[model samples]
Target chain A: MNGSSKKYWTDDPEMVERYVLGRLSEEEKRRLDAEIAECEPCREMLRRETLLAAGVRRFGRDGLRSRLRRRLVRERRSPVRMYQSVGLAAAVVIIAVGVGVYQMFFADLTRPTQFGKKEIVITQGGEIGEAREEKREVRTPEEKMDAPPPEAKPAVRSGAERNVRPAEAAKRTAPEPIQEFAPAAKSDAAAARSIWLLGTVVMETGAARTGAAALSAESRTADAAAPQASPDRPVTLRRGDVRNDVALRQRPLSALPTARRSQMGSARRVETLVETTGDGGLQLTIYTDDVAASELDAASVETLDGDSLVVTTATQRILYRLPPDLFTAPSVRTKR
Target chain B: MAARLFFLTPDAEILDLIRSGDEEGLVMLYSANERMVRVFVTNNSGTPDDAEDLLQEAVIILWERVRAGTFERNAKLSTFIYATVRNLWRARLRGMKREVPADLAERDDASDEPSPADALAGSEMAAAVAAALDRLGEPCRTLLLLYYWEERSMEEIAAQLKFANADTAKSKKYQCKKALERILTDERII
Candidate 1:
């Protein structure tokens, strides 16, 4: 035995056993401490017991402590910190459960009765008032109050309703007060038919009136009466053979360069019937032969009167009437 | 007092420092305790990758608990940290999404190596000692090992393993030693 083990052995057996087994009380520890300071035999015994214990402990030699330490250190630095909120976890569970329960039982409760009633109003045309009245009867007083206000309800005008078959049926059943306006209504209907026919004629004739053939006849008339006309006021009409000449002249041509003019000529040809307005600005009907296609590309077509000026592109609109010096490119221009 | 320090220290201290806002403290805390947490996780049946993930989760939980002032210090700092890691690993086990390999379930008892004197006795001697320990039965062996290896006090060992009192721990310890000695002498391995 070594000196410490021998010293421990020489001391009380109970004390040696207690210390060796690591069960020594504080008092026993203090006593051993005092005894070992003087006793070499007791010290020697302790050494032997410790060796025995050490041999027993080395059975499994894995570096579990160091591994554990390394693991602990790594865990402390992990990035999973974002998901650690218990409250958030609980809240997610609650929301999921709530949705599940709602789907299982209350799903049908959420469907609005007004949706069905609105469909009926649209399909049946003139029965909108009766449908709304029936809807009000079905709802409770509290539901009526809680429901959207009257202004929120969509107003369906009977006269403006299309699908004439349904409208005629509704009108036959309508009250006598509405019947009194039938004569006045017939006159209004006749006027609307006349306007529709006139629109078709004007659209077809405008371009034909400005053609070269018409211009030649006008020139012949002017030449026959040439000497009789006033000398001081010359009626000089510059008739170019170009398809877009009349429309181009009617626009502010100073803004458009030759390249853009040719592009406009090929991409779009405008027909205009110009009449002088009382305000001195010309009343112009600037029609594009390809109005549907050009409207898709252009910003918008605004009608001054019977004349509509179709701006062929967005950039040309910015240069309208404005001097070149005053035109700055808009900072945030959008094109679609 | 040490346990109190371990428990009472807000988990959120590092996070709060990170958020309000000390970026360095967050890094320091993360780097420091990461390995121990991983080992604890692995010991409790988590995969090596799972251990890594769980260690991060444990740290994050610690941070959140500290922030919320919810961490309760009931054990030593190391013990509490190990327990937290263990709890997280246990939760993963219960989830049953994946199988935990058998090797991870084995306890890592090798950290408590016996003293150099015991080591010099050779593997045969160590086996002899373990065989002696086996003869003492569960409670005595448990108390003896916990006393020597874990360095638990009589009160702590009694409370942990749930013996009657400190006196029970002492008597159990004496009996275990006597039993070990008899076994050793009979086997002629001491």
Candidate 2:
């Protein structure tokens, strides 16, 4: 075969094509195949064309596969519907079982932590700008004692809000501090809630104006601090000729609405809002209104039902029980 | 109603399975696309036998490509099969009609019948030969493929490629084969 190929092989490129395609006669194909088995160049040319032809074939068939696949799927859908429904039901059941098992075996047992809520009201003429929050535990007592206080962050204060306390009415009015505290996540991972306040904090426990600085119906008293803004309305005075007649026409105690009294009761009973005012005072405005009830932390919500003045200061929080009527007077005064 | 096999499997994995000589993969392909190929051939002046032959030949070509790892990754398998079956069927139609294919779908503008090379319609080489063929190029590559791969006559080649005559086609083939050898020699492809 080699001898035959050698004799006729001179410049015979077409022979490679013919041999590959099997156009060669029986004798020629046999001889060429034998020669190709031995000859490297002949072998390589044959292989390349074969692959190229194969690639061309693959290209032509490309469009048909996807279309036919769709057809096959369409044809089979009616028969598969029953099985599909069964499978879907099985999947739902499995998910339910999994959830039940997890609840039975992996549920956590710890009770949810409770926070004492306080309402800090800055009463500067009776314009009550109340701020409420329960906890701000960034520094341990030891750490707070060791460190100089950090530079204060920005807070928003309204003209009325800033002047709620007569002591720091000089504070510049600015936007209230936008402290976005994320709702405590339900996850097991516990992290510190960061607090940034610009004004004085008045921890408002429902009780205010209960001490010697407060007034009776027949007397005038004063203590103009945050946690209460003096009223913006003009005074309607009614002084009686009787001795001890600082006679302010008192709104009959019956005039206090039942709901307001309850709300005020809860507001005074439990601490709700803890606002900071000028000189960083703890401002508390405890609200027992249904609206405020929704916001008071669990601990302070309970505390609101009691008449107590909880003063949250830079050092610590102090709870003082007092009569709910302390806030009933239109205006209160600090002893001269 | 049978679940369609191809839909259940992705295209890439189908190629991988076919390359691995999985019978299920080939059956999935046949189940999905055989009707289309049959419809195509019967519409194009081909008999049932002709359609069967064309499809079987397409399958053989697919098997060869997958085995050789020559199939393009991005190209769709169905289109490649369609093109192959179509090309092969056209030649078969030409064979059936000594003068010209009567069906419009099967008809081509070529004025003449294929020469002797048409006899070598379908074939594959040993892996070694294909590897060596990789080294040859140009007029040689096309010449070698047409004469050997497609098995067209020198007359058909002269017409298709616009060579002067059968002799020109013949001489071109000779030079190309020698060039093929030279390429293989330089690369030590043997």
Candidate 3:
């Protein structure tokens, strides 16, 4: 074992490892120790093995410990990053909830297109009075149209609907705001018996047009009534002879067939229209007739009754409720 | 702080990490016993730096045993770690005592302890080997570290480094060790 050419215990890799790891028995260790003292090559081999193990341990320690320390440093700073991420998420959720709450409780539901209905009650004596206007507006058609003829639509009247005020009617009809207007009532007598309303319609304008006019009718009352034609229905406006000078003297008091009636192949352009409301009611719109007011002398006039008159020109209309003629004689002549 | 949280990790997980030769196991053991070792060393005239170095050495000892499949789960991991730290610190303190010339000579002559001259040569050689291992570069560097320090089996080395088999891993390790020795010899570090 001491000779350079002879095999020593340290020449065996497993023996060298077992010796270095202190795994040898006392006798084996004593024998190896004596051989190492006498054997220069074996001693050098043992030293080299020891040094290699030490070097690897140093490298593993430095590398693994540095990584662990870095992790410690990074983790020390992570609480703030976690808070920032959590706070951003919380802020987003809060904003979303705020918007939803505003929509549910605070947002304005009624738009300009929605108009509150105003009921105008016509008494048996032909006196017309309107219900008080409500603060809330009604929801109507997406696009405002001139009143159609008085169509008889059967409104589904619930106990809730029967007691619905103007504001409640607006809410109750909100779901189906743009219902189609039914065909007009057959006659003025039928219209006089139905519920009548005064409404404003704001026409949609082009995006480029900023100042489109909003057309609304002012409610007025008739001050005079014609002689009762029948007891079964209230006396309403009846068309009269246009050429009669005596009937023409009824200042601002004339009417014509409704626009809906005119639309039924009469070929006459209807300047004024009366439409049935969506909820089984009737609506009459008296436009502020710019053409009639500007050309009063040339405005076409026809008789309705002594009380209500519709004065219209080609593109303009005005519904005038003349002063009651209780003091004047009833001289209206009905056209056959 | 998150590393401190790893101190709560159970011993079973740490053992699994050791058996798998995961470096994270070393980190966990180092951190888990860091405070205890710090207190022990500092109370015994050792600084915080000494405590850290001693703890790392102790953990490496455990890693070597665990990787070699020789570690006994006879006690709690922390208990083993604390005892190892105590022993390492005692050894370090004894070495410090031996730094004096008269005591070093007496210890060297009286026992099988290496003489001061031999210790200095050994320290220098160890440093040279470390530098040569660095220059030896990857696969070899890792192979030597796994074999010499972690004492992992050839089969584990093959699986970990994706070698075809344990025989292949053994062959590669032989080559890597030769290369490391070559670097040391060429650099006149041996």
Model 2: lDDT of residue A291: 17
lDDT of 1 by residue, A1-336 (tens): 443434443356555645664456668668777877876766766765765565444322122233445655565455554355566888899998887556434444222223334411221213332123244343322122222223421111111111122334354544221111111111122111100000111232343222212223333233221111111221222213211111121212222222223223222233222222222122222223222212222233232222223333222321111111111222111111
- Candidates 2 and 3 compared: the better one by lDDT is 3
| Ranking of all predicted structures according to lDDT, beginning with the best and ending with the worst | 3, 2, 1
**Top-scoring candidate (TM-score):** 3
- lDDT (Cα atoms) of all candidates against the true structure: 0.40, 0.41, 0.49
Give the local distance difference test score of model 1. Answer: 0.40
Per-residue lDDT tens digits of candidate 2, residues A255-277?
A: 22232232222222322222222
What's the TM-score of chain A alone for every prediction? 0.21, 0.22, 0.23
Candidate 3 structure quality by residue, lDDT tens digits, A185-301: 112222212121121122112431223232223211121111101112211233342222211111111232222232222222222223222222212222222222223333343
lDDT of 3 at A173: 27
Candidate No. with top DockQ: 3
Q: Pick the candidate with the highest lDDT.
A: 3
- List, residue by residue over B20-94, the lDDT tens digit for candidate 3: 667677777777898998998787778999987887767766776787666777788888777777665655667
Error of 1 at A227 (Å): 44
Tell me the TM-score of chain B in each candidate: 0.39, 0.48, 0.73
Error of 1 at B140 (Å): 1.1
lDDT of 3 at B76: 80
Which residue segments of model 3 deviate by more than 4 Å?
A1-5, A80-336, B1-9, B98-122
